[model samples]
Target: MTYRGRFAPTPSGDLHRGSLLTAVASYLDARQADGAWHLRIDDIDPPREVPGAADRIQQQLAAHALHWDGSVQYQSQRHDAYAAAVDMLLASGHAFYCALSRRQLADLGGRHPGPAVAVSPASHSATNTNPNPNTDCAIRLAVPDTPICFTDRLQGRQCLSLGEADGAFVIRRRDKLYAYQLACALDDADQGMTHILRGADLMDSTLRQVHVLDCLGRTRPDYGHLPVLTDSDGNKLSKSAGAAALSPDTSANLYGALRLLALDPPADLAGAPCAEQLAWAIPQWQPARLNNTLTFGVADAP
Candidate 1:
């Protein structure tokens, strides 16, 4: 299959150094392979989206000469697609309705401890269960007991087992919103994405997405996770963490992002135009050079 990659960003805020680094890395990977690079606005959660975050993200990418190959896709407009996928999973018994509230799950934490938690199958098969649920109820995937393993292009071999007590992972929230795992898997398949280059912070999400792909009988793309940019306190730079918005100094921003990616761009290119710097750096882009190290102090970029 032809190489097809994407840079998917949640439109919670403007692009910061961390996000810029991901965009640059993904862009280079696609361009270096002479493949198609697509941009996806993950705007599924309206409560987290900013008014102009999506447009600003596009503008920032343009400023850095990171132009995508096709029209941008917004997750918000594809609710019907997500709904259909959920329905298919439900009908096939790959997923089930979840009436347990967040507080209820928290209360069951002592009974089910781990990074992954879910209600037991027996509990779901108990009396008063509603398989075909209403909007207020969440929908969870019935993950198999087998270990989910995949060789990450950057992080090396990775594995995780979803325990029986961990119950099920929600595919749809109680508020009637599709989960990231479900949406991302379906979207990648629908878009025919061949590869996924994103931040390492989402390493855990890979297993979940892979499971979703298996349930949907869709192909799983190759994944490469870049190092995540963090703050002084070692917290990952995120909109929730109040990462400052990126400045319009496209050249400096691109140079800084390249350095963070472990790409040694020429010092003289600091003052060069964004296009010139990208033109010089694209041929030199090396994803393997990144050592899976979290870059601290990225919020202090000049």
Candidate 2:
């Protein structure tokens, strides 16, 4: 099958060096395989989104010559699809309404306080017997005791026991917003994505997504997590951490991102154009070279 990959970025801020690294890695992987690469704007949470961040992100990618395969998809406009997924999970007895508040769940320990079981949707109304009459309900997936395991192309074998902390994970928030875990899983399946290339900072989320895919009876895509860029203090570089936005100099930024990925480019290519640099680096983009490394330091320039 032809490999299909995506770079889904939240429109909370402009593209930082860390974000650029992930985008470049995903772009190279898809191009190397002669597969289609897609761009997805994860703009579900309106309150957190910046006004023009999504457009800026697209401009940055274009500046670097990393164009997408087709029209970009925005999660905010795909609510109908996400809703259908939730309905399907509920009907199949994989998820149910949860009236438990965050405080109540925390009091019972952050993880699932009770035994894990397959709960029917009918049980949602029966189990929620709180007398306060003021609690909103969120949708949660029933996690089993079985381990969720997948062999990441870069990280190798990995496993997570969903029953540990918070036995059941929320797929929809009490405020009626769809959770990232649910929306992302459904989008990937719907878009026919065959591979996921992202940063190691999201490594833990892999299991939760796999569980969602299993519940929906969909095929789980292959995953590859590249090393996360970190600040001098060892914290992961992120929009939350206030990482500086990348400059529009595509050649320099591309070189810098490639260096972070441990893909050493020729010294002479430092002054080359973005497209030329990418052309030279595509054949040398060996993901295996990033094996076992989870984080790397950011440099001053490309």
Question: Which candidate gets the maximum TM-score versus the true structure?
Answer: 2
lDDT of each: 0.82, 0.84
Per-residue lDDT tens digits for candidate 1, residues 1-302, read 79999999999999988888889989888888889999999998899999999999999899888999979999999999999999999899888776665556667662223223333334532234453464356788876777888998887887877644364687899889999999999999999999999988888788889999999999989998877887778788898889988888888889898777667888899989988887887789877777555454645444
Expressed as tens digits, the lDDT of each residue in 1-302 for candidate 2 is: 99999999999999998899999999999999999999999998888898999999999999998989999999999999988999998799888776665556665567643323222233332243432213466778888888889999999998888888458888888788999999998899999999999999887788899999999999999998888888888888888678889886778888888887778888888879899989988888999999998988645334
Error of 2 at 244 (Å): 0.7
Displacement of the residue 225 alpha carbon in candidate 2, Å: 0.9
In model 2, where do residues sit more than 4 Å from their true spots? Answer: 113-135, 299-302
**Candidate 1 residue runs with Cα over 4 Å from true position:** 110-128, 164-167, 292-302
As for candidate 2, its clashing pairs are 111-165, 111-166, 112-166, 112-167
True lDDT of residue 84, candidate 2: 91
TM-score each candidate: 0.90, 0.92
